[model samples]
Each structure stands twice: as C-alpha cells, then as structure tokens.
Target: MNEQETGERDPGSGERVHWSEDGAERSALWRSESGARPPGKLAVADDRMTADAAYKLACEGTALLWRGDYHGARQLLAALARRVDRKPPKEGATPEESFHLYRQARFRRARVLGMLLVPLQISHEGTHSAYSVPLRRAPEVAQACEEAYGPPGEELTLVSLRELQGVLGAHEWRRKGVPVEALGGDRVHPRHGVFSPVRGEYVGLVARAPLPPGEPGSLVAFDIGTGTGVLAAVLARRGVGRVVATDLGERAPACARENVRGLGVQDVVEVVSADLFPGTADLFPRTEAGADAARADLIVCNPPWLPAKATSVLEQAVYDPGSRMLRGFLDGLAGRLTPHGEGWLILSDLAEHLGLRSREELLGWIDGAGLCVAGRLDARPEHPRATDSSAPLHAARAAETTSLWRLAATG
Candidate 1:
C-alpha cells in the first residue's frame, strides 16, 4: 500500500518542513502519524529558551525545532502541559455539548504540545535501519522509531516530540504486551496506531458469553474489527474451532495477526484484511453442486462507542463518526449468520449517558436490520477513568455499562 492508504507518512514525500539556521535554509522530511499539517511558522529553540517563552511561541502557532538536551526538552514539554491544564474548557449546558467542548479542548492541547519538534537523523544500510535523535542526552530510539515509522529512507525526518514519546510508549507496550484475563493471562501486543485491548470488560464478556449450540470444536466464529485479535484469541482458546477475524486498513490486521500467532492460535484463527464480513466468499467458496456453505455460528463486534468524528489515527478506536460501523454491522449481521447463530455486539452506554446516541435508536437499528435481541450480558467498566472525577465527562463515564447484546435473526 502507498503512504496514504497505510496511514504511514513517507519521509521522502513532498511534505518537507523548512527552517532557517546560521543564515541557511534547512529542510527535512516532515512526519506526523496524526496527519497534522506542518506548522506555518518555525523557530529554533535550545536550552536557553524558557518554558514561558516556548509556550507563548507554541500558542502563537510557531513550531519549535529543538536543539537542546533531550531531558530538558522533555521537561519543557511537561511544563507546557502544566500550563495547558491550568485553564480548562468551559463546561457546556448539556452532556453532548460538554463532550464536544471537551474534545475541542483536547485538540487544542494536542496541537500546542505537538509544536515541540525534534530532528531524527536516519540512514538505511542493506538490512539494517540506523536512526538516532540528534540532540544532547537523547535516548537510543532507533528500535522504537523503526518499529513505529518503519525502516527510514536516506532522509532526515522531522517529527513532533509528543508523537515520538507516544511511539516509544507504544513500542514498550508492544514489547511487553498487555495481559488479558480472558486469554488465561496471555498478553496481546499492539503495534503503533493499533488500539490496545487494555479494556478487559468486553473481553471478559466474550469469554463468558454462551456459544451457539454445537460441539466446542465444530463451531465457526467471526470476529469483526478485531483490533489486536484479543477477542479472536479468547474465542479460539474457548474452543471455537474455526475463527475468522477480519479488520480494515494496515495496522490492525498486521497487529492482530502478530498477536494471534504469538498466542499460539494461528492454527485455529485466520486473520484477514477486510472492511467487515470479507464479502463471505473467503470463508465459503462455491462447491461442485453450487451449494451454499454454512454461515458463522457466532459473530462478535466491538465498534467504537462514540458517534463523533475522530481527529487522529488513535481516536478512531474511540470515535465512530456517525455510528457507521455499528449500523453496518447490524445491517449485514443477519445475512451472514446461520439460522441458529448469534451476533454478539459488544458496546458501551457511555454515548447514551453523554447524549451522543440514544438507547432507543440502538434498539431500533437492531430491529430495522431484521434482527432481535435474544439476550444481553452487561458489565460495569473497571477502568480507572470510570471513577476518576477529574477525567473529562466524568459523570457519563462513571455510569457507563458495557453490554454484549446477543442477537438473532427474526423469521
């Protein structure tokens, strides 16, 4: 895939960022995983730059190319964060309004903090990709950068320090992996730009949900939008013999496949790159007599909960724009299920609490899709943010309940 399709910015692409230093114009390949446009104004900063001055420049939309010690840069970033947090967005009258305002505030904060930039010097040597931060006291980030951005071409890349820190954190998470209780304590390693299965409530619900009537080794299951393949692996471990896990775009499929293989379920789970159902042809092909093969006995999906626009690649895991994935899953569910099959839609009521979507609308969609709710399994979120009053939309989050809706086709 090309850079645009894969969400990977080409360092050698036309998105070059230029700045002035020592009476010469210096330019480097600009990279942003969030797809943010390069800053229109540029300034060179070093150890002598104060946090206040830097914050002012950033607020005025000037990107700072750091030429200071790495630790000091981190300190300045933290200082800027403190300043940003000192002033909070004004709460709106309604829950939905408040949620939108909160998102706006976050966007502004990210934009300002993202202004702190760093230069990454890189080279490609046959099979080895060498990279480093060209600043004093900079940590060894070659492996992290390589893992997140892929092997670099022979170009100096300019990236935001905020994004680089995220890359480093994602690398660590990918290396150590997150422990999923539903997977018998096995871990799921998420790559950069892929959503991590840190929220275990949904996984637990899937692990405990009742499977369709069949022998453990005889059932076929489909996991839609399998982010890190955690749910797919859970189903495989639960003895659903044949599991087809489908995901869209580049990172998710690759990440899910890696996790599935690492968890030793590659033999049972097939990871495919498709929007949702994989058009059904991949799982069932035409036979000699042109007979239709049996559909999946179980189909599970955990789409993004919020019906709002996502500003970055990471937010796609949290925001669902217009509930497109949810509605699409429901609309196509019945046609892809066996007569006695169950479609488990794992979702949260946070949107309802935030007034972004109504519970009535959800049920209506289910009915309109020629399906009915057979049963439902509910779990309260155990994530710390659920109880953190300081978090955005705390009231909505505190009352959130994640449910696994067991659905079946209506005759």
Candidate 2:
C-alpha cells in the first residue's frame, strides 16, 4: 500500500518511505540496551505463542517479533507486565534500600520487555495496508508513528511496542494538555521529550510571590530554563511588561514559544534558544538586546534540582550533574539583577534527602555567588508517588518539599 494512505506525511513523521538493501525486511531498527542485538535475531511469534512462554522468552533476553493479531499482542504485552510486577521483593532489604531496588528492578524489566518489536510497511498497491501489523485489535497508529519515527521513508524498522506506547502517551498529553490553575485554568501542552509542568506548587509560588517593586509603569522579568513557558506566561499575565525566557533543549524553545502564543502573551514574552542565558554563561539574562539591555527587576529559574546521572534523554530535565544549572543561576544572579531585584529559585530538597547533594553545599554555592536567601516558601509534593507506600523511595518522597527561595544579591 501507499505510504500516504497509511499517513506517512504527518509532521515530523517523514515525507516518503525508505527501504532496506534486500528490499524485504526493515533495515533500520533500535532496541533497549538490554534487548537482543540485530533485528535478524528477532523471531516472529503468532497467536499460538502462549503468554507464559512469551514472558519466559522475553525475561531470558529474547526479542519477540509479533505477527499475530494486534489485539493479541497487546494482551500478551499486558500479561508480561503483570507477571513482572507480581515478582516478590528481595528479602532483608530495608525500606529505603527496597525503594531503590524496586526502581532498579522496574527499570530493568522495562528495558527487557521493550524488545517486543512492531513493524510499519507498505504493500505493492500503495494503499494503506493492514497496519503491516498482524492483529484483529491492532490499531492504525500512523499518526503516532509519524510523530515518533518521522517518515522512515521506505526503510523498514522495528520499534519496541513500549516505545510506541510512550510516544502515543506524549502525543496525547500534547493534544489535551495539563491544566494549570495559576494560569487561569489554561493548559500547557508539552512537546515531545519536554518536561511537563504538572506540579502546581511551583507555579503557585510564581503566581503568589510578590513582584519586585519598580517604577509604576515598569515590569520586566527573565525566566531561565522556561520549559513549557508556564512560569513566564504567568508573569506576563500578571502584568509584567516584558519577560525573556531562555531554554536549551532541542524542542524546548519551540514548545515555550507555542505555549506563550497560546497564553496570548507572545507580545510580552520572548523565547530564546540558549544555554543558561542568552549571551554570557556567567550572568543571568546576559544579553545585549538594545532596548531590553538593562538588568531585570526579577528573574526566575527552575533548574534540574537533583544531582545524579540521567539514564535517558527525558530524565535530563530532572537530573543534573554537579548541580551545574543551579550553581550557574546562583553565580550569575548577583550581576544580573537591579538594586531591589530578586532572583526566585524554585527548587526541592529531594537531592538532600537522597544524599546526592547537601544543604551546606547549595548554600555555599549561593554565598560564593554573592547571593543570599531573603526568604523561602515551602510546599510538600501533592503527587501520588509521595503517598505510595510501595514506592522504593517512599520515605524520601514523603519527606520531600519544594521551595521557592527569594534570593537577593549581596553587595
């Protein structure tokens, strides 16, 4: 069938089809680090393959090529997951250790199970084929495919069903968006891989925090690392005359721009593609924009607060090595603010509880940067994970509290 009918032209999906050397099987394929190597090793499975057998094979590091009815594959996948989740925790593990172990186990399970491969292909008729996927209940995920893989063109590639499901979830989140009452109940639609601002306390801090005093008609702020531009939009709607938002992620600038436009604050908010700040890495909002050259009356930064190694691209938003972003923001704030200005640092104490970073170290960095905490506001996390007793890090989560540090440059 033709690629167009199967919806290959979807934005970011790809333009045309690309094929393999032999012109038979998919050429481009990727699997999780733990999955079996080389697509050639993947053997096709059908309705006859029992879920127990599939589960055993998958657990033993064998990648499955599902050629059964689509619905059956999905059921198989679910059964596999149920089996994995039902496994008992290790004996003699402490509550804290158990949490860490659970996270590790779940991560490993996901990586191995992600080996179940699905294919997208075209037939000679150039018409939308039976999803090129066998199954009575398999869906036409052309749109999802396009969004995730772009147009693989004619190349036949195998993607994990787990990965496809993740893409579909992100697509749905982008389509429907998460509501932010601080933004007057408006929603922020996160682009693929961009961090979604579902946590409301941080936004509430931005909404309720007092704006630095300036001339009656003066209101300007800088939002560093504005992911979905939710904080920047809140400032603009709060009557800030101008707000400069900067982000470095590949899709973050576009995501922030779209959100600002949706919030009807594009005129007041500017989204810049940058690392840390616009120009110099040593200063906050260190730009040379002619009219907006002056230092800001208020600056806000919500850095990746945790100090750890990130295993995936999406995890980078939450994990930071050496607290780089946090230190950079603190280091440059003293030189970036007006006399009465304040640098609002939205952070959490999770890293401290996990022993990844210490309060003293963060405070030392702030002091070394010539900044001082004017005051701090705190809010406990409202996410269900905090209350999940089974969570490997439940103790840390329950004790976690997000803080908005009202910082002032020390002269």
Name the candidate that leads on lDDT: 1
Worst 10 residues of 1 by lDDT: 1-10
Q: What's the residue-level lDDT of 232 in candidate 2?
A: 93
- TM-score of candidate 2 on Cα atoms, chains taken together: 0.82
Displacement of residue 229 (Cα, Å) in model 2 is: 1.3
TM-score of each model, in listed order: 0.94, 0.82
Inter-residue clash pairs, candidate 1:
none
The worst-scoring run of ten residues by lDDT in candidate 2 lies at 1-10
Index of the highest-TM-score prediction: 1
- Model 1 segments beyond 4 Å from truth? 1-12, 89-92, 123-127, 280-282, 285-294
Candidate 2 lDDT over 1-411, as tens digits, reads 101111123355333223322235333334232233343244567788888888876776566766778777777888888888887778777554664676588677775567576765533345543224334676666665555444435545566777667777878888899999898899999876788998898899889888888652376688999998999999988888888899995578888999999889999898988777565433433444542434778899999978765555566788787788988888888877878889999999987777667889889998999998999888889888899988757777899999999999889
> Against the hidden true structure, what lDDT does model 2 obtain?
0.74
Candidate 1's residue-wise lDDT over 40-157, tens digit each?
7788888899999999988988888898899999999999999988876575468988988888888999999999999999756688768889899998899888888877778888
